[model samples]
Target: MSAGWLRACALVVMGLFSVCALAKDKQPTVIVIGGGLAGLTAAYELQNKGWQVTLLEAKPSLGGRSGMATSEWIGNEKTQPVLNKYISTFKLSTTPAPEFVRTPSYLIDGTYFTAADLTTKQPATAEALKRYETTLDDLARSIEDPQNPSANNTLHALDQISVSNWLDRLQLPATARQLVNQQIRTRYDEPSRLSLLYFAQQTRVYRGVSDRDLRAARLLGGSPVLAQAFVKQLKTIKTSSPVSAISQDKDGVTVKVGSVGYQADYVVLAVPLRALNKIQLTPALDARHQGAIKGTNYGWRDQIMLKFKTPVWDSKARMSGEIYSNTGLGMMWIEPAMKGGANVVVNLSGDNARVMQAFGDKQMADQVLIRLHAFYPQARGAFTGYEIRRYSTDPSMGGAYLAFGPGQISKYWRLWEMPLQRVAFAGEHTDTLYPGTLEGALRSGQRAASQVQDLAAGKSFEPAKVVPVAAAAAAGAVAAKKGNFFTNLFGGDSDKEPVKAAAPIAPAPAPAPVPAPAPVQAPAPVAPAKVEPAKKATVKPVAKKPVAKTPAKKTPVKKAAPVKKPAAKPAATQTQAQ
Candidate 1:
């Protein structure tokens, strides 16, 4: 061989060896599907533990249900430790929860009832409320572990019945029955759909961990702040890149997003079960996993924020706090005063949310105003404008959160928590200890991250058992005696914090008087459309603006159409395995 030819071959051989060595030494890669709390937490945990993490979020921003609204933070003391860890890690600041003076009265059937009215105006209701508090507390205590309440036969029996049926069996009075239904709707966003066991488990989890009455502490900038913190630490994050399919082999997992394929040693599927159903998985999921996904229902609720010239439902109006109504406007409350001033937020769920979804944005706002006027006539014309966030319509998040229907716990709960080969799960739905709450999402993520770590490290992994700590035991005692049934039941504050009021802003010049919207004619309900398997196609990432607190404009209403349900196949079915 010529001298020059030999030198060239030697150099090429050395370069190839260097490339192979670098590839062999690279850290294992993990692809997290979903940028919500669970997804972000999984990514953060994996990254810290030496995994090269790539997070994919279908939405334009992170922090799934937690970041959807800006009015209030929905979490408790248990959430504080996880949140504080992130805040300290990110060097971010948070605002203390706002304190408000709540009126000691409740509005029912157009008439406001005071504390005395409980005995005189509605004696039966008073009796029922007492019974409810006692019964639920006793039931919550029977379950040694909130995460595995099914182990208790009594609790398991309750799981077979809906909350409505349980109340019926108890022979609750009419007003009390209505109040309980309303409370469930406001709290879980599903009045009749949730099981009694599920409801009790949620109650105990909060009672176990919270120091004070449970109240959501607001993150000063909003949930996106925490999301941003997680994003900054991530090695790669592809927002607006929805996963089309997931295929796994003995070697690694391949995630398909549009035309690109990302291969990772392991995968974390953190999206909602409904969202997960959209993606096709090769070597279809087993029967139990498929059944769990098909059986799970995502709860839906609509949040409406009305900016006003003043706090119309303040102490002067004889109603200082949240107001409940039967008029399909489930619950209304004024947010704590902020730098921008105070505003009223109406939460619509259950039948109320369904009724409101038919109208246009402005029409819905008008209807809400009409309902408010019925209770406080003097507050007419104080309305400035409104913004609506319909969780049902969000593409990424099909609904607010998962609500396990009756009989689903035993049939699907275990399957949902079990990991499939190469793919682990994480989300609020997978968490039994604190289901449907922000804390649950974080815990599930931690669990999934641990599982991923074990898998990558070739260690056997088992789901962690939830054991009650001293705080939960002590809190349980306090909750049994002192808990305000209505407030604590709905995961909000029953006691007010001392207020440091913000300076009031000069009311914006009143816009032209908005004429009352024409009454909308209800359309006949149509059968839900059948969802089909997603076609294999490249999905381009669409650029979206960062999530910001902007005023939503009034838009013209269009006739509503029936919402189609997505068709499910075994492989496309969702699993809660995290």
Candidate 2:
């Protein structure tokens, strides 16, 4: 062969290799673990970005905790664009909370009072509530950097104590405390179990919206409708496929579920902290990440639906359709009267739910009915049948959502948001803004998708940008002032003038400050950037939560005999489950 000929042959071979490499790089495959909102969202985003994606869910269905029942789907005005994009794309219908339910009628200490009555009936309590709210707003403003909430000394100090302790320190009236505690239990499943910092951060995130507005709107059908829509758009979704183990190398990732193994260029883990802890990760997760998965607490929440032969409370007593209770059952929301009859959804959380679970399903239902009669004498024979859902005992989902205990936030907040090698973590738990919410899950999924894309392209992954709390709140304040229908309805402050909506909601407020290290220390190891071909997969086996069931019968009774009350239990022995 002539020297010129040999040179030309070499050049041709090199050109072919380059084209092959480029093609391989362009079509990276991602494996999404968990078929919940976060995983589905990650898959959707990646697929739209031209990446091949596979989603594996432990449960037979999607939606995770959000799919359990009919409830409101609330989000800040800033998150409207993102939420609307998905809602519109899926053709889902949403209706704002009805006027009757918009402003909750408080049932405090057996007394019913409308929202307007709060200021008039208990002026002192109202003033105290106002002062507490103002304090939270000021603290939220002091948290200039949402991304590093722990950087603030005040917040850090607050993190050292439970929310109950903080409230006690405020010296709120006993009735006011009861009202606040009831609200906290219903929303977060035991404020005493959560850090003050965590509670404060949540307050800041929702500063734009009032407590009533928090349950802003509901999908026409339910959360599952949206979940099903997301499923339809996914290229591949394997239900009842729980990830038992995950192994990643310089080249790609291997996920093992039951007896089958799947390989992809990248992985997105969208499971809750509890579920994530169950999966074995090869190369081992970073210490901080592992600690976070193990240390974080997931709140327990149970829902019981009761169907009646008729609209009992509304027709018989002319009562407001909602009840915030101090009983074992946390709260109840009477659904709009259906053509057939009416239904009341009872929310149980924390220790209350745990205690009731021991009473067995049927007995628990009976107990709840009995309690209902106590509150409403006319309700004695009104209940027909009921169904209960226990989320805490679910194998796939350990709890309703993440709730940070005292000190856990500072130790693991940074780790929750970090990506490990070719794997990225996402879920409401990992999201700082709108934590434990559908909006947070979506935002986290989008973020993980971006990170996975960058990793596949052999580019450095950047942390999600943090929007300033003050700026977002200011925008919300402006919108409230302007009288934007949604904003005015949801945001707490309606008197302010209109201004442009701010950036996406920011992260948790900054924590109390800590002293600087004596000397600068070396930075932690960063996940190396690399990409390689995926290898053949192997199969392994894994475990699943009970869902609330629809009531079958709607029988009613005209009247019933009085029932005995259960003995009082010690509070110390009752632990918050969710």
Q: Which candidate is the best by lDDT?
A: 2
lDDT by residue (76-144, candidate 1, tens digit) is: 434445555566678876555544322224567767665466678778787787777666765566555
TM-score of 1: 0.72
**Global Cα RMSD, each model:** 15.8, 16.6
Q: How far off is residue 415 in model 1, in Å?
A: 2.8
lDDT of 2 by residue, 285-304 (tens): 66777787766766667778
Q: If scored against the real structure, what TM-score would every candidate get? A: 0.72, 0.76
Give candidate 1's whole-model lDDT. Answer: 0.60
